[model samples]
Structure formats: C-alpha cells, structure tokens
Target: MPFQAGLGTGKLAVSKVSASEWRARSHAAEQAGDLNGALEILEEGVAAWPDDAALANSAGNAAMRSRNFDSAIQFFGTAAKLQPRLLEFSLNLAISLSRIARYRDALAVLAPFTKEGFSVARYCSVRALAERGAGNLAEAGAWFEQCLTLDPKHARALHGRARLAMQRGERDAVSRYQQALQVTAGDAELWLGQAQAMAIAGDTAEARKIAELLMQQAPQWLDGLQFLAQLRLAAGEADFTSHYTIAMQRRPQDHNIPAAQCAVLAGLDFNREAAEFARSAREKFPHLERFALLEAVYASAAGENERAQSVWNTISLKNNDERIHLARHQLRRGETDKAAILLDLVLQEDPTSISAWALISVVWRLAGDPREKWLHEQQGLVAFLPLQDAENVLPPAIAQLHRLHDTSAQPLGQSLRGGTQTAALLFDRTEPEFAALRDAIGATIQDYQKALPQSDATNPRICHPVLRYRDVPWHMAGSWSVRLSGGAGDRHASHIHPLGIVSSALYCESPPDAAADLNGDPQAGWLELGRPPPDLGIDLQPITAFPPRPGHLALFPSTLYHGTRPFTQGRRLTVAFDVRPEKEPS
Candidate 1:
C-alpha cells in the first residue's frame, strides 16, 4: 500500500505490511530462540513507522515478548502519543508502563480519560485500574464503583474492585466479590479475589479448595499457582507442586511463576532448573523486587554468595521488604550476623515491626530469654489487630507463611489492619512429642493463646498434631531434609507457622565444624522460639529455653513465633514441620 495522509492509514500500511511481515518473521525467530532476528525485524518496524500507532504497538509487543521492556515502553509510548484517541493504544501503553513500573506515567496517561466527558464504563474501568496501580486505594475504589454502576456486569471493574476490597480489608467486599463472580464466573482474577478473601478469613482449607478449583478450571492462572504454593507450604506440604508445574507449562517464561516453582522444587534435576529459572526471572523483571528475592535465595542455595549479595544491593527502596525477606533466608544458610544486620535495619525504620522483631526474637530464643522479643513482637501485632473484619486477613495470612529455616515474615507481608482474631492455641495432640517438653510448650501456647486470641485458624483453642516424619514430630507436611553443599552461608529470619496449630524444629544431623556458644564452644546451633513486640523474656522458668540436642524434639504451637540460629559448621542438616489436627467435620 502507498503511504497515506491519515495517521491511521499510515499505521495500517506499516502494520499491515512491514510490521505484520516482521511479526511473522519474529515468531519463527523466537520459536527457535533467535533473539537477533526478532530484535532486528522488530526494531526495523519501529524505525519504519515510528508515528504509526499500530506499527509501534506491534513492535512493542514483539520486544516485550522477548523481555525487552525498555524497548517495549519506548515503542508503546510512541504509539500512545501518536494515537491518544484510541483506547486500545492507551490501554496498551498503560500495561507497558506498569511492566516497567512507571506507574505514575501509566496513571498520567489514564488521567485524561477520567474527566467528566469520559463517562463510558470502559473509560471508568481504565481509570480505576490506573488509580489502583498508583496505590490510591480510595480513589480507585470510587472509580470502580462508578464503573460498576454503568455496567453492573463489568468484568474488569468487578475484578479490580474485589481485589481492592481484599487489600483494604473491606468485609463488605465478600458480597461484592460474589456479585462479581456471578457476573464473570470464569474470570481467574475474580477467582483469585475469592480465594484471597477466604485465606484472610483463616478459612485456608476453604481457600485451598477454591484454589484447587481454579487450578482445575484454568490451571494456568498466576495467582492460582502462587496460592497453591503457599497453601502447600502452609499445610507443611512443601513439594505440593503439581498444579504450579502445570501452570509453568502454559507460561514457561514468567519469572514469578518459576519463582513459585523453585519454592517447592527439590531433587537434583529440579535444583539446576529452579536456580537457573530464578536467575532468569531476575534478569527478566529487574525492577520487580520480588525477583531479586528469588534470585538471592537460589544464588545462596547454589553457593554463589557474591551474586546473591549483588542482587541484594540492586534492589530499590520500593523493595526494602524484599531485601529483608532474603536476608532472613540467608540465616537458613548459616549467615546469622548478616540476617541480624538486616533485621536491625528493618527495625530501625519500623521499631514496632511485627515481622522483623518477631523473627529476631525467635532467632535469639536459644541465647537467653525469648520473652523480650516476644513482647516487642506483640506490640507490632496489637498495633494492627483491631481489624476484626475478617476480610482484611489475606495480607496477614500471606505473612503467616513459615518457610523452613528461613523465618523472614516479609516473604509473606503484614501490610494491613488485622481484624480482631480469637487467637486460639493449636496443638496436634495426636502427634509424637518429647514427653519432657510437650506439656510446657502446650501450656505456654494455651496461656498466650488465651491472652491474645486470634480468630485465624481452626481449633482456636488447641491444635492437635496431624502429620509427622520418621523422627521430626513438629514438622508439618512441608518439612525437608536439606544439606548445603560446598562453601555455604545461610540466614533464617523469624516467622509463625501457616497451618501451624503447632510447630517444631528437629535436628537430624549437625555439622561437626559449626560454632558453639559465647565461650566458643564447638557445637550445633540453637532453635529459638519466643513472643515478639515488647520483646519480653519467655518467663517459662527453666523449661522455656531448651538447648537443642539431636533426637530431642522442640514442639510449640504454630501461633508462637520462632527462628533458627545459623549453624556455622559443615553441612548443617535439619528437619522442621507445622503440626495441625485432621479437620473437624464442617
């Protein structure tokens, strides 16, 4: 086609000829993983019709598919500027901006469409989404409401509003979500919202059930994959990854999906792929702090200390929590001091920090009194606990994910008000336990559970043990037999159990070369357990501070916080678990 005057025609020519031709070429190139061919053709299209919105849009899509986010943004911006009247162009621009996390720019692009004349439901939906991306919760909510009134069955608005409600801890949102589902039952986003609400309400089993349903239905939803990973971890079922692996089948290159994959992967074959995938994710979504976290963990796991540290250094301020989260993971690799430094830094900014303080106290449980840390942790907990509105629990529920050895709470997050929880004590009475220490932890758990009632878990009174290993009783389905090879250092921050009606640490083997005590005694590290906030000493008399011995079990309720000291010796091997009872009939 000859060049035309109208901007749209120019676009049609470039996209219909040069751009479309390049796309076909790019597809074959990408299918063979030929980056150069794809980049050349895509870049050529960019140069051919820089002002043709469709051509630019096509170019951007090709770039983004190849993980060239900067190129994508550049091309998308050109398209958006050239054709500001087209909603698709603007939406594409917005999505591209979000990928680069230029959220302000994304919002600015959508801002013009939210004016008085922009009464279209789709326009309102676009603005609502942009506001949400900008973290303006209240403004986003209002826009979503406006969109809803215009189109009662508006899918995007319903989905976005339900997510906002979940984030803000809005109880009324449950009804809103149900209505949204009624409108769009097949929507993965709506399903995710429903699952999140159920998770926050401490109906994790229900959440898991919904998640399984989603997995069964879509099998490829990102949120569904993440939820299943967390749910498995929470249930002490670490390798429960069938659904997530299936998700990877659909989105093989998604960095977050692989991050979820690595979380549950074990064995030699998976270890290599998981570590590499984590690295690839870091390279792909360089701005997403969460990617850095996965990179750090995998690097540390692979004994690439410098890369892990380098990854940590690159994280921006917006990702402070992610760094802290990784630092805690280092504790698992035997990097106590490093983990401590991270905790201190986080506490410096948030002295009333729930996660840092809780894990800090838990890590130090073996040194002396755990009460002070416990007390300090309580302060953080109490600060947000008045939000008895059950809908607000998803973030906290996310925070409740207690990974083995890695105690960092930021891996999960506690960024919202916790509605009043009945705080019941759970102890899997049926599981095996050390006769000497069982009663002590059980009583302490009961006392604390009574004093601080949280209504998040089943059997809010006492949790009976359901799963145990050959020797490790406190461990839930998620416990593992892990050994760090070669030169390795680790960090495990503080955290509570997910399905931890009761939680425990068991040392199956100890490195003969690890550090001992303040006296430089050559011995294994201690498993610390305690409360948080005012950072009180666990006043359980002599019984509270138990020095770990091989074959000696340390069992405590899941609600009680805990962390492990970095075992400085050779090949520190341990197993841990969360203990909860078989579900009572509904």
Candidate 2:
C-alpha cells in the first residue's frame, strides 16, 4: 500500500491499494465537511500517481466545492486529458470555465461532445448553459429543448428550460416549473425559480408558500433566505428586518450579504439600523472597501452630509470603484467641481469605464455650463423613433411585445421599484419577435450615430481611450421588457445605466390616461431624466420628461439618471436596453 518509484521514470507511483485508501480517507473528510482536508489527501494521491485521472478528478471536485475555480479548472483539465473517455471530466472542466465567465472556453470544451454526436442529456444541458452564459439565448434554449427531448426527465435540462421560460413571463414560467417539479420534485433551484416567478407575477402569497417550503426543506440554501427577504422588502412587509437578520445570520462570513442588507435597509429608510450594520461590516471586514463605501452611502442617505464626507475621505481611492463612490457622494453634496475631478481621474485610469463617462456628463449638466455644451458632451443623449407600419401605425412586432410581456417567459429579476423585467440579455435571442426588435433598434442606433456631434477631447464619450467612432456602430449590452401593474403602477426609480454608453426605452403599451392627461402636468406616466436616486439625498429635479406613446422609442445617455412616473390604472409595458458604441475596425 506504499507509493513506489516508476521504472526508468523520476515520478513516484502508488499501488492500487494506496490510491484506494487515499480516496476512501478523502471521501470521509469531504463527508465531514472538511473540504480542505479532502483536497489535501487528493493532491497527495495525485502527486504519488501523477498519471491517475481519478485522483486528479477527486481534487477537481473538492476544489469546485471550495469555490476555488482556478484550481478546479487545472485539475479537471488534467483529468480530462488523462482520461478522454471520461466525459464527466470534460463536463467538469467546462463548468469550471463557465464559473469564471470564460464562456468561449466552456464552449470549446463541449465542442468534442457535440462534434462527435455525443447526444447525452447532461452534455446538452451543460452546452446550453455555456451558450446562455455567452449571451446566446436562442441557442441555449434550443440546446435545453434538445436535451429535454433526448431525456424527458433529465433534471438539469428541465431546470434550464424553466430558467429560459422565466425570461419569457409568468404563465410560461409556471408551466415549465410545474413540468420540472413533476420530474424533479425535490430540486431546490427549481423550487426557488418557481417562487421568484410567483413573486414577479404578483402572486406573493404563493411565492411566500414556496419560499417557506424551500427554507424548511433546505435551510442551508442562501437563495431561499435571500428570496424571502427580497419579497418582504418588495411587499413592504414589516418582517423585512427579521428576514434580513436571518439572512445575515445564515451567511455572516459573506461580505456581500451584509453589504446588500445595508443597501436594502438604507433604501427602505431604516437609516439607524443600516448605519449600525455598515459600521459592523466595515469593522468586521476592514480589507473590503465595499463595506466602508456602504457606510458612507448610508450616512449620505441619512442626510448626515458631514459624516458621509468624513467617512468617504477615510476610504483609500486605490480603485475606480472607490473613486466612483466618492464622486457620487460629492455630486450628491452639490460639489460638482470635486466630483468632476474624481470622475476624470477614474476615466484617466480606465478610459473604457462607462460609469465614469456617465458621471462626467452628469457633472457638466449640473454645472450648467450651457445646455448645448453638456448636451454635445453627453454623446447619444436622447433620440426618438417611430416604429411605423404600412398604414403609419405601430408595427405588429411592437404590438406583439405587449402579448409577449403577458404570456412569454418571466425574467428572474424583479425591480426594487415594483415591476417585472425580463432577463438582461434578451436581445441576443433570434426569435422572430426579438429579431425584429433588434433590427429596429440597430437601425435607430445607426441614425443616432450619424446625428451625434463631432468628437472633442472635453466630451466624455469622445475621450474614451479604446473608442474613436466616426460612425457610431453599437453593441447591445442588455435588453429587457418590463411590465408594471396597476394601483400606483410601479414607476422605475431614478438610476443610471452604469455599464452602457447608451440606454433606451421602447414603449409597447402606455396606460390610457398617460396620453389623455393634457390639462395637468401633461407628462404623467412619462419618462423623467436628470433626477438622482431618492435615497441619495439629492434634491435635483428632472431636467426634462418625454410622454409615453405606443411604438415610441426613447434613447439617451446611459449615465443620465432616468425613471418613470406612476400611473394609477392599467399596465404600462416597455422594452429597455443598453448599448455600447462600438469602434469601427480600421
């Protein structure tokens, strides 16, 4: 049972008995939740039997469990090469790649399986996930369906279908969830998806039931606890504090948990508790700037401007994130000059920083340099297009958007402000309806590019290091449809599209009175621009507003904060997207 030296080789070799003993001990350690111990044993076994795929795979699995994706990928790649017949090794490799957002690498690993016509359900499901991660939703959906058709009861395939269905809308999502549950009744992820869908569909009672069941059945699953807390916050339930407490207790070591809790509390106007949580998080995770940033943000939100400024000053501006937060704080305090300096420094360090560019535009606007100067500086500000048909009415595609919002798959994300939005990457889908919308948007973007003012060094959009666009070709960053329901029909909150060069809203349906409210503020149920988020303690009013109309497409700078006014009755459906101005090839 001892490791032996290989003949004429410098490597140590292990007898089958020794390898087996190592695996047994590793398995026991893993079962006892000592993943590090398990990995240590596996690594030792791998070193002894350098050519052994099984030992490498064991190490890979342990690393994956520990969320050490880089180590997992290394081990999995070695295992896959050592044992080409073991498709599971390749699958694990692909999954590890995907975990790090190396979607193209994941697809490359899956290529052999598909090229050789390995029609395994697991392979198809994994390939689908890779495609989805690469922003190829149509391909992902097809692969999921292909997997399901190969094996009707494949749990992973069912889960994929359910997830894609959620992007469509509530009814489709419910059907997929029901089908998935029928096959895999105990699947925690499916149950979580169903709960989220229920919440988005305004069936909070059913959502709560499902969430509670998840908590009972899988108490360790953080998604369940987080979902419950989110639902409570969304519904304005009094139990949000309790739910937040439970979530924090469940994952106290996770810095994101506390940071999210603090943001939510501050957003909900629980300033005192949020301030305490931020302070605790900052003290607990001194290395993490996010907690410190949260402390400053909470202080500002609480109208403690002096404290906010003081706390923010203590944060080292080593990264663009810290600089951006400080810049925002300065902007909130009406210190435009200071904010501009910080923002410019951020852009100087990372020229492609979309958020920095967005902020710079805001600073110019607030400085009141001249409407035209700032307007020109903020490239791709606002453009409107009409989706006219043969009869000059809205096209059928625009009309179909409303029905799609009602009947298609529901997205997983629910707006904090009170609306249901589709998946962020929906524009990549090649469905006829989606394709039409994409084409229309693309054509509009071309027009927008042609109409932009000449580039100047002072303009944020023109000053990007990686981009110098003569013809403003653009790439979609994200696209989603939102459906806001009646009774104070949820208005989108004032926020900037931090990641995009341009942002847009194409109205599919407007509440009836939005068009008819001519006597009063006329712009009721309209899109308002320039106001900062309410929680920022910024009192700036909207610079302008655009009334909602069917088939009207409104495009603006992603950095300019924009939102909608509430409508008392009827649903307002719109598609929103973000885009990056692509530099044309030389």
Candidate closest to the true structure, highest TM-score: 2
Native RMSD of candidate 2 (Å):
6.0
TM-score of each: 0.42, 0.74
Off by over 4 Å in 1: 1-39, 64-67, 83-88, 202-205, 212-586
Provide the lDDT at 360 for model 2. 72
lDDT (Cα) of model 2: 0.72
Q: lDDT per prediction?
A: 0.54, 0.72
- Looking at candidate 2, the ten consecutive residues that score lowest on lDDT are 407-416
Model 1 TM: 0.42
User: Model 1, residue 33: what's the lDDT?
Assistant: 77
Q: Write the per-residue lDDT of candidate 1 for residues 282-320, one digit (tens) a residue.
A: 677777767666676566556566676787677654544
